[model samples]
Target chain A: MASKLDLDPRVVRSARRLAAKAGQPVVDLARSHTTVSVERAVLRLAGVQGADQDGIPWVNRLVDAVRADVGLGHGVAVPVFHAMRSTGVDDITVLAQKAAAGAVRFDVPSSRSEVAAVKRAAKRATGGGLKIVDRRRAERERLVKRLGDPKQRPWIYLIVATGDIYEDIPQAQAAARAGADVIAVIRSTGQSLLDYVPEGATREGFAGTYATQENFRLMRAALDETSRELGRYVRLTNYASGLCMPEIAALAGMERLDMMLNDSMYGILFRDINPIRTFVDQRFSRQVHARAGIIINTGEDNYLTTADAVEAAHTVTVSQLLNEFFAHEAGLEDWQLGLGHAFEINPELPESFRLELAHALLARELFPDAPLKWMPPTKHMTGDVFRGNLLDGFFNLVGALTGQGILLVGMMTEAVVTPWLSDRDIALQNVRYVLTGAGNLHEDFAPAPGGFIQQRADEVLGEAVDLLAKIVDDSLLTAIAEGTFGIMKRPADRGKGLDGVARHDDDYYNPVTEALEA
Target chain B: MSIVRPYGDTTGDGMVQLSFTLPIPHDKRAEGAAVQLANKMGMDPALLVHARPMGDGFTFFVVYGKVSHLVDTEKVQVVERDYPLLSAKEVNATIKRRLRRRLNVVGACIGTDAHTVGIDAILNLKGIAGEKGLEYYSELSVTNMGAQVSVPDLVETARERKADAVLVSQVVTQRDAHLQNTRAMSAAFREALPAGKRPLLIVGGPRFDELMAGELGVDRIFSRGTTPREVASYLVHALVGSSS
Candidate 1:
């Protein structure tokens, strides 16, 4: 795809270089450190399962025991595998139970041979789980090939977050029947802040469903059934973020989820998860996502909710470029980069729709191969269903005209209540109306030369390049600490989950990460 | 006088400008197609004023045209703000005089709705749109739980805090998670708290229906562009004053 705005190739190259330079420090930091979540993810890959009587996951319990005994510098894998080898227990759950019952202890490996023996045991243990992940990935590709793609570019990505996994299935199927191409099972509120993923089937959730491994398997099966029924693949999405980012990503992969909301800075900026912890966790998670072929949707749109969308447009673009660099570094292809933006400029601002077009089209042109997740209006819904519907109509038009990849349908009765099924039906109708009405609108539209849209895109690109240069100079971590991206200042060392981060010892071993990287 | 029309350049003229994109390269043929498409959409004598190529096989166009449509203003139904916007001082004074204690309010982004700007705008001390948030009010005790708060936890917090109002902000309305979460929160409160002791349930987001609070089982529903002062005033009215 050629540049729509004829964006200066020099600026693009400069921005790319600066973003690469800016992200290197964080990437190096991620390489040097491993969070408790990363260790838990390793244990999960080694086939650790279930919680104790306190509902704590065995992976968490094992990591806790290891952290308490060996102080976590040598990584949980080394200590846990040494414990497994010494105890002569092939099952990690049994080892966890014994450790939890205080029947076993973990300390630093006594010798080089002990370390080598533990690494070999860890490799053998995690090999089965990695095979399962590989099988799931192959199964996902097989199913998609068999079921076929949706008939359009911007697949209608609806959501079903009924707290209860069972309750979500029917709603999801109804949405697919109603023209939705993708169904995202929204995780329950605050799940991201939790250090462990919930086990088994969960019945009660507050705002959204839990992103447990069992829950993921169930929802994936349901969506697969729906896909077969609809004759087009219906992708399932869930978040692999928060304190247990890599663990959830591993689970999403094992359950064959098609997409994951795996952003680097979202937890740090929004949930206040520590920057070091988030960066480390995001790298491992993106590795799993990349291996599983999961398209990741970054959270650049959330910036608009906190900062002024118009004044901060450049920040979103800058973040996208950074996210791109990070994703590429994690071995993800451009096709799997569902980079996010939103149609969230204040509607009262004159020519807001045109401005939205300029922004959305700029993203579309900038990352042409990437499937951009175009978010609907949340910052300006206004609670008036009539106006909200109209605003969504305009949003859909912009998506259709600009060629967004994933379009989350907007509900009209937003801010009023939990949408009754009727509200979803109406919202879907609004999308269908605009998308079908202006289905080919993109073929008939282009910005005027040197007009507001063209000029805005150029100006935003210029601002983004300057910001990238500053970020490269000061480093991304310092910029984040000083509130650069989302206006939320999150210091590198201060915030939630900082205690979970550990500087990896040279001998620390993670078979899963090594396998993914290999 | 009762009727209205799009007042673009002049009243009753119905003149408008529409912009669009075509896949064909920008040329005489693309400009002609833009005009033809505009005419089909009810614009008469549509004139293509601008045309530009956007990459390969794509063209954008801006067209000016006239329409023959008018809207009757009298029949336009809207959900208007019935409550008056009060000053922060008035809100604090009313709460102090009537309740004789601080108004405890707990706000959160319950469910998976991680967007917190709306909840923060009303509950955080910084506020939005040049107005102070509920935290700035002297008589309002605001405890913002931040994003992704569970309903059961929100209920427990409301109970423990002895809250006068429980504000839940939902930013992700995908598949009606916001609405469902609100309903679930309201139901949890109904089950947990006695009718007389239950906190005033308030849910605000950009996409809420102002009139559906009763249906959604909440005390009040605030919509877009809501200021903290207005929320504070409403709390004073519903919880402290004669309106209760």
Candidate 2:
């Protein structure tokens, strides 16, 4: 069955060649060789290659490959350097097109072969890949450390992505100071899809701004600076989705960014990105996130923009579970998961707040350790700027009540236009009041057990299970073409970048493969 | 027909549609000014609801209380009737048999609008219509000029190459970019060919469609939600079936 993303024929042909060399179907080889399930098997079949091996240590092996992919020059090709076994594919002309015009990379693996015998513990060395990391315990530790528990939640999460590193740095610092736990620099809205990462800082952008390495570095430094000042680590985030998701993840990891928006399905849904490509890229990017200690932010909030947030509430839950599954496969700890949702459906809905509480609580329960990114509403604003502000106030109230880990402040002028600094101040005031007035709200909070709130949460889970079951039975790839998620119906045989994809023959030319293998 | 139970009057109540994308953490006072600007545009302040901020600084809105200002939506007929639509199979078959040759379709992002996103949505190998792009059809040759092609140069080349259809995508309409290029495109179109033999002109943008295309002499317009299938269907129906 074809994927929601049409598999590039070049990727198909490369997979055929790779399989021929290994004497097996790439899908079968990946299924047998790796722990990822069949859902992502289609991605492996699309010629998305991985790194040589994890457990191998070579910090300098990382390069600035992502820069050149986005029209900058050749640096370390961090994603490529980390490419353990498949580093050779980076140079393979056939795979270059699928490489996202040198813009993207598929899943690459890392190795922790260097953590020598522990002198302190004496009996054993615990850090040799998943052999040492207790996934379940680590996830729980993360959850307790940050969010407390499903019953008790924490503060709001917001984003700051101005194109200029100079601009983003100060803005991120301000957000962190203003009580934002999470700061996401919206990568110049569509930079993820670009094959290469821009070299340095950029000033202008179409919507939000660009997410260059320099910008990432500048913002990460600023956040780190604030984290020290605030006495708590304020996490920084940017998109690692799009064509170069894996490569960006590598960069984020190198730069010590706290989190990255690395969803498997978001690319296909909003960007018309092929499902196979997205999955493959996501897997690769997640692997990088695993190595970098970066939390991965999924785009369930985006699903609200296209589909109805109220109606598709379950989708957020479902995506969280799937993201949980993918994050696990990529070896990401629950602590490193920032699953997303939003409060953007019309506030006029009678039970709007109740629905939001249900959704937020469900995410908290489902992932438990993930720092869930709660979004602000904007879908149905008709330009009544003042009412828009009041609506945002209600959004803030929901964040406080539901105990959301990350609360994105809603700007009242959502439907009207871009906000000025004055708007930011008022928004900050709204957030400050809610945080101050309701600082202890979570302490006294108690949703009636097994009541409408809990029941609704359960209902969304059921819907999610049904959707996943169908995905399992019909193939997630086919479901994408069928438009099971977004209203779009992109066929498996079509989409942009079809011509840009070139298949890998036998001898692809990446050097890190041997270096990692060594 | 009047509003039942009398809500605040919204008629003529002329309104200005003011929308701009700003940075996050919206300011109510700044938003008020945006609404005030609408009032300046002759729109009553009471008739607007979307003077709010768009997240990440790119807000979208529509002000529709009552335009004591009217623009004749009825007289606002688009160039939709200029061509008929064919199915994917029909589209492929028509070019092969009737044109007696493969029709070449060239697309580009004219002027300083470096955004190739919208045009790439149409003419690339992943054609918009359930099928692939014009490249998929054996009967049509396609050359996508990607981004940053000047309007005059684009016209010179399309004419030199004798394109069957010229697909123009206008993005980055910030600060009347669209208006400037719209005029440039017309001038180039006028310069590129004698009015009679110009290739079927198709204009698409976030806000433009064949209606604007007809108003500007473009053969057709495919608006934002326009599908690749619909575009393919129209192209085939027009080229194979009729011209006038």
- Provide interface RMSD per model, one decimal: 11.9, 9.4
Fnat for each model? 0.29, 0.04
* Residue range with the least summed lDDT across 10 consecutive positions in model 1 chain A: A413-422
Where does the lowest 10-residue lDDT sum fall in candidate 2 chain A? A117-126
Residues A1-518, model 1: lDDT tens digits:
34567778888888889999999999999999998899898899888899877789988888888888887778888888888888898789999999988888997687999888888888888887888888988987888789899898799999887889899988888788878898898887778888888899998876688889888888888888888988898999999889998999989888898999988799988998899999999999999899889999999998998777899999999999999999999999999999999999989999999899999988998898999999998877766778998999999999999999999988886656666565676778788888888878787687888888999999999999999989988889999999887777788879888999999887777788888889
- Candidate-wise lDDT, in order: 0.86, 0.57
DockQ for each model: 0.13, 0.08
Residue range B44-152, candidate 2, lDDT tens digits: 5434465444333433333433333445455555545445656667777777777888887888877655455467657655443234666666677887775557687
Q: For model 2, what TM-score is found for chain B?
A: 0.66
Q: How well does each candidate superpose onto the true structure, as a TM-score?
A: 0.77, 0.58
